[model samples]
Structures are given as C-alpha cells and as structure tokens.
Target chain A: MQVLYFAWVRERIGVPREEVETSAATVADLVEELSAREERYAVAFADRAALRVAVDQTLTDFDASLDGAREVAFFPPMTGG
Target chain B: MRIVVQDAPFDLGEEAGRFAQADAGVGAVVTFTGIVRNTAAGDLKAMEIEHYPGMTEAALTEIAERAQTRWSLSDVLVIHRHGHLTPGEMIMMVATAAPHRADAFAAAEYLMDYLKSRAPFWKREITADGAAWVDAKDEDEAALDRW
Candidate 1:
C-alpha cells in the first residue's frame, strides 16, 4: 500500500509519499505500523490526536477499515484559507 | 458548480455576478474571500503558500461536494490561489448560490469550514528575524465541528 504525507507532515517525514507493506486492516493499525518504521515516521505518527487520516481520499476515522484502500494519507488538521 | 484552484487573484464582484446570474432561479449568492494578512501573532511580515498538486484540488473538490450535499445550493464556486501571496491579497473565495438565503449562507459557511479543516495547503511565513512554517490550528478544526 501507498501512504502519503501532506503539509508539515511531509516536511517532518522528509518525503511526500512512501510505499509500505503492512498487514494492517484499519487506519489505526496502519499508523501503528508506520510509527515503528523510524524516528521520523515515529514523530509524524506520534500524537495521533493532532493528526487526520484519509483513506482513498475520503476523510475517515482511524478505526475505519482499509480493506481495499490503495492510498492512505496522514497530515495535521488542515489550515487552508 | 465551478471549481478553480489557481495562482492568480480574482475579482470578487465579477465572480459573484457570474455565479449569481448563471441561473435565474438563484435568489441569493453568498461569497467569502479569505485574505493574506501582513501580521500574524503580531509580528509576521509576509507569507507564502504551498500545496500538493493533485491532492490540493482533490481535497477542495471533496469539500465542495460536502457542502453541496448539506445544502440546497444551485451552484458553488470555489477559487483558491497558490504560490507567493502578499498581505491584503486574496487567498481564496467560496461562493454559493441558491434560491433562498439560508441555503446560500449555509453552503458558503460549510465550504469555508471544510476548507479550513480539510484542504491540503500549507502556509510559510517570513518574519523580520526568519521564516517558519505555520502549524495547523486546533481552533480551526473545532470551528467545523459546530455544523
């Protein structure tokens, strides 16, 4: 599966996107997997309270199932004009 | 529904006129323009905006769709600017047209709220001392939860 980062999360992660192989079934599970990757990933996925997740471009909860999702994105709560 | 995510400034009057007159049945048109400010936290001087190419438009469209679903809007126009922006310049516009004032107002507010909490744009501010990225605000998200 592909994971995307946007806004300051990208700046922190040092990459706009990444491909990860995970057996995670839900968005929360995916975050747990990514948080274990490295220090940067850990920092990005740390404090899930401050983050927002989208499965396949639709805003969703962390408990939402990612059964057939091709893409998952994580970023801070948006602040666009 | 016209959605334009561009890097140029737009005329509010012209855009509002076009959106309102597009359909004779549109009795109300509500438009909101967000502007770049010269000061932030009382010291910022200038600001620059960055966005993900494909993702920015996609997120904005999703916000527009949400507004449409919640309101009896006849049409929606969303125009957001990117690249370098100056203080007092327009950052974005959300215009909603409907047969009644309620629909237009609701849709316009919904569009702004969703954009504030969902759009994929980042702001970088340059102060007298240095430059830094702006963090997302919790209050912005809390504002969306009211609706």
Candidate 2:
C-alpha cells in the first residue's frame, strides 16, 4: 500500500509518500505501525485531533476499514476555499 | 456540471460569462470567487496551496453533485487552483445557475461552504519570517450543519 502525507504532516514525516508492507485491517492500525517505525512518524501522529485521514481517495475516520485499500493519506483539516 | 482542479489561474469573467449562458430558461446566475488574503500582520509574500491530485477533482465533483441535488440548479461550475499564489490572487470560484434567484444563490453558497472544508486542498501562508499552514476554522465545519 501507498501511504501519503500532506502539508505539515508531509514536512514532519519528511516524505510525501511511501510504500509500506502491512497487514493492518484499519487506518488506526497502520498509523500505529508507522508511529513505531520512527520518531518523526510518532510526532506526526501524536495528536490525532489535528489530523485527517483518507482511505483511497475518500475522506474517512481513522477506524475506517482498509480492506483492499491501496492508498491512504494523512493530513491536516483542509483549508481550501 | 463542471469541476476543474488546476494549478493555473482561471479567468473569472470568462468562466462566469460561459456559465451564465447555460439555457434559455435559466433566470439567475450566482458566482462566488475566493481570493488569497495576506496575513493580518501584512508581511505575507505568497500562499502555497497543495492538494491531492486525484482526490481534489473527485471531492469537488461530489460536492457539486450534492449541491445540484439539494437545489434546483440548471448548471454548476467549480474551478479551484493550487500551487503558489500571491496575496489577492483568485484561488477558486463557484458559479450556479438556476431558474430562480433563490436557488442560484443558495446552491452557490452551499458549494462554497462545502468546498472550503470538504476539498483536499491545504493552504500555507508565506511570510517574510516563515511559512505556516492555515488552520481550518471551526466555523467552516459548523457552516455545513445549516444544510
């Protein structure tokens, strides 16, 4: 699967996207796995309140099922207009 | 319905003109343009907007579709720009055409409200000191409760 970071999360994570091999069943499990990999990931995922997640291309909650999902994105709440 | 997500600046007048000429029965057209504003400190240089390429178009189309379903809209147009933009530059615009003024105005407002928070774009304000990501206001999210 491809995990993507955007905006401040991208800066904190130090990469825009990365391929990860995981058997996680949900977005939260994936985040937990990543957070254990490095300090940057932990810092980026520290405050869940400041972050938003998207499974595939659709905005969803952290508990959203990742069944057959190929892409996951994490970013701050959108500031578009 | 037309949803455009691009990095290049768009011509508001031309887009509005084209949207207003939707159909003979269309009696009202409403357009809202969002501009990049400088920081309150007034030292901002530019605004950098980043967006999920594939998701932006999809999300915007969904919002436009919802607006159309909620209101009696004859036509809808949404154009949002990403990448670097100077203060005061147009960032995006939404135009709605309907058989009556009330529906046109309401639908246009609905599009703006949803586009502000639902879209994938994120804005970073560049100042002389440094750059900072703009936080999504709580009011922006709460605004959706009206619908």
Q: What is the C-alpha lDDT of each candidate?
A: 0.83, 0.93
Question: Please, what are the lDDT tens digits per residue for candidate 1 over residues A33-78?
Answer: 7788778888888888878888887778899998999999887776
Best by lDDT: 2
Clashing pairs in 1: none
Name the docking class for model 1: medium
Model no. 1, DockQ: 0.59
TM-score of chain A of each: 0.92, 0.98
Error of 1 at A70 (Å): 1.1
- Candidate 2 deviant stretches above 4 angstroms: none
Model 2 C-alpha RMSD to native: 0.8
Say which candidate scores most in DockQ.
2
Q: Write the per-residue lDDT of candidate 2 for residues A1-81, one digit (tens) a residue.
A: 999999999999999999999999999999999899899999999999999999999999999999999999999999999
For candidate 2, what is the lDDT?
0.93
Q: Chain B, TM-score, each prediction?
A: 0.93, 0.97
Question: Which residue pairs does candidate 2 place in steric collision?
Answer: none
TM-score of each: 0.86, 0.98
